[model samples]
Target: MPLTFHWFLPTNGDSRDVVGGGHGSPATVSGRDRPPTVAYLSQIARAAEDLGFVGALTPTGAWCEDAWLTTAMVSQNTQRLKFLVAFRPGFVSPTLAAQMASTFQRQSGGRLLLNVVTGGESQEQRAYGDFLDKDDRYRRTGEFLQVVRGLWEGQTVDLVGEHLQIEGAKLARVPDPVPEVYFGGSSPIAGKIAARHADVYLTWGEPPAAVAEKIARIRGLAEKDGRSVRFGIRLHVITRDTSEQAWAEARRLLDGFDPETVRAVQAGLARSESEGQRRMLALHGGGSDALEIHPNLWAGIGLVRGGAGTALVGSHEEVAERIADYHRLGIDEFVLSGYPHLEEAYWFGEGVLPRLRTQGLWQHPFDTRTPPSAQVPFAGAATAR
Candidate 1:
């Protein structure tokens, strides 16, 4: 199968520097130079769509705009671009969420994908009036998926699980094509729930060995449940015409990081209850030096970011090679973003995506009619100027 690619929506904001504010970290004021207005986000959405990304992931949390609302508005601006709406399951009832998904699918012509985020920080959850502990939150997510899945299958669900109870709950009009659930977590409980429920199991950008181990573990668990799930990795990218240019961009972003801000963000993330965040911290160790954890993988993003901190930094060919390596380890999807999303989308889309096509690993999702050479809409736009 052709590898699937997805981009991100900087709902909080966008900047040329590393934007903070994920998991438990506070939003970086300097990174908020370009506000996440509907116009700006629409430009990104249209660009990703024209560049052949399967979808765009819009995050949910206290730090960013609401996923559901932002995607709904953006959906009107683009055709054929799916929205991977990241949402916490506990804040809203499962039945209501199911109904909303149905409405979104119907209204947007089934351009909805759900990213189920079980809140990882205790204090952050409390800020939203949720008092459940981490373990309970995971349990609630499992139960919530059960009810939501049942209702989506057009069944009257009466699940009386430990965390959720639904009595004769049913959707008035079930979604024609149910949105695939994309889930990520690093704990044992999280692995079990993902194996049983998620259609796509997402992981942060880890080293090849670590990522392979995770794929093996998840595949085994899912097999036990008589299910198979696709795997995806989330990372930032810094591809350029040459290796030197790429590293220069990485250094520029690294240089832009304030020493105190990195320290403060790392300190804040230290209190995160997320196992995934813990693994991210392990990769970089909150140090700015020697950030290349693996070939072409730079961990500088984790210095101030809370989740998915590593980036693929190299020339376009090198970046494509790294992606191919991940694909060999069972990653069939990639959800990626960069310092400035609009221009970076073109960098990877025009430069690296063509190389991937040459290797027979990818094809434009919506432009099968066009040849590979004509796939990227702005292939020569930069030079044409």
Candidate 2:
């Protein structure tokens, strides 16, 4: 399969500095210069569409805008960009979720992708009235997908699973093309669920060896079930004309991290029930030193951010090489973002993507028109200030 790329919509907000929040940490509010209004988000959406991104991911959380509602509104502003809406299965009924996806698929011209996030923090889940323990949440997620998938297949589902019980669940009109399911988790249960249902299994930015191990494990499990699952990795990015410039940008973001905020966010994440969060913490160990855990891969982002902590930081060619390294290990998709999403999208879209294109590793999914040349100058000098 051809490689695919997607960008993130910082629905909580955007900033030149890193905007902290995810996994269970509170969003840092001091530097959020751009609020997530429809107008601003639509600007990012339209930019991602024109730059050749297949989709944009809107995150789901109490800290961020509601993914379904926000994407539904933002979808109206862009013609071809699919919204990879992140949603928790436990917050809503499976039947209603299925119906809403069917509606979104029809209304958005078949531009919908689902990122199934099994809520990982107990305190946050309790706030939303979901009381299941960590492992049981994964179980509930499996059951939820079962019903949702059956309904999307135009079947009237009747299942009495351990966590969810549904009867006669069917969509009035099934989605013309069923939305692809994107899922991620680091635990054994998560692997099983991905094997059974996920069209694409996602992992956070780990080193090449770690990611390869995960791909092998998931492939083994999926093969046992007579299935195959594609792979994707999520990460922040800082690509520039030279390695030194990229590292300088990384240092700038790191310098902006308030020590107190890092301590508080790290403390909150320490209590998280997510195995994935555990691995991320191990990469930097809640300290700021030795953050370049791998060549051109920086862990400084994890100091304050709660999830997807590591970043690919290098010149455009080096970043493109890192992406190819992952692709050789079975990752077909990359979900990427940078500190200030709008400007960074242009950085990677114009800088790194064309490099990948020339290497025959990627092609635009929407049209035959070529993307802007890698040499095209970006006008967002304000981001540097």
Candidate 3:
């Protein structure tokens, strides 16, 4: 399959500096210059669409705008971009969630993709009135997907599970081209749930060997159950015209991280119940040193970030090479973001995507027309009046 790339909508806010806060950490609102208004988010959405991204992911959390509502509004601004809306399963009933997805698909012209988040933090989950422990939440997620899938298939689902109960549940009108479910977790239970239920198993950016291990494990489990799953990775990026410039840009973001904020965020994230978060913490060990965990792979972003803490930092060719490396390891999709999403979208879209196209690893998800001729050299062109 041709590689699919997706951009992020920074629903909490956008900033030049690293916007810390995800999972269990506090959302950094201080340096956020661009509030996540419909206009601003629509700008990013349109850019991603025009740049040939297949979709844009909108995150869900107490710190961020509601993913469903935000994406529903942003979807109207783009004709071709799908919205990978993230939502916690424990927060909403499966039947209602299915119905909402059905409506979103119809309204958005079948541009809906679901990212199922099984709540990982106890305190955050309780704040929303969910008391299930980490393991139970994964169990509940399994039941939730079962019910949701059945309804989307136009079946009368009746399942009496430990976590969820559904009786005679059916959608009035099934979603035409049912939305794909994207799920991720690092625990054993998470792998099991994903193998049995997920269409694409997502992972925070890890080294190629680690990612390959995950893919193998999930494939084994899925094969046992007569199923197969695609793979995706989430990461921040810093691609530039030259290697020196990209590394310098990465250094700038690293330099912006306040020592105290990193300490505090690390302390808060230390108490997280997520296995994935644990692995991310181990990658840097709460220190700023040796952030280049792998070739062109930087862990500096994970210093204050809770979830995806790594990034691919290098020139367009190097970044494209790193993506190709992961692709060889079985990653069919990439969910990527940067400090300031708008300009970064253009950087990666124009720079790296073209290289990938030349390598025959990617093609525009929506457009196939030959690109327009290169703009005439500014120095040679007549000045506009």
Best by lDDT: 1
Clashing pairs in 3: none
Worst 10 residues of 1 by lDDT: 368-377
**Number of clashes in model 2?**
0
lDDT of 1 by residue, 184-278 (tens): 99999999999999999999999999999999999999999999999999999999999999999999999999999888888999888899999
Model 1, TM vs. native: 0.95
Q: Which stretches of candidate 1 lie over 4 Å from their true place?
A: 27-29, 369-385
Q: Candidate 1 lDDT (Cα, whole model)?
A: 0.92
TM-score of 3: 0.95
**Regarding lDDT, does 2 or 3 come out ahead?**
3
Which tens-of-lDDT digit does each residue in 33-130 have in candidate 2?
89999999998888888788899988888788899999999998777899999999999999999999999999999999999999888888998999
The model with the greater lDDT, 1 or 2, is: 1
Query: For candidate 2, what is the TM-score?
Result: 0.95
TM-score of each: 0.95, 0.95, 0.95
Q: Model 3: per-residue lDDT, tens digit, 83-125? A: 9999999998999999999999999999999999997899988
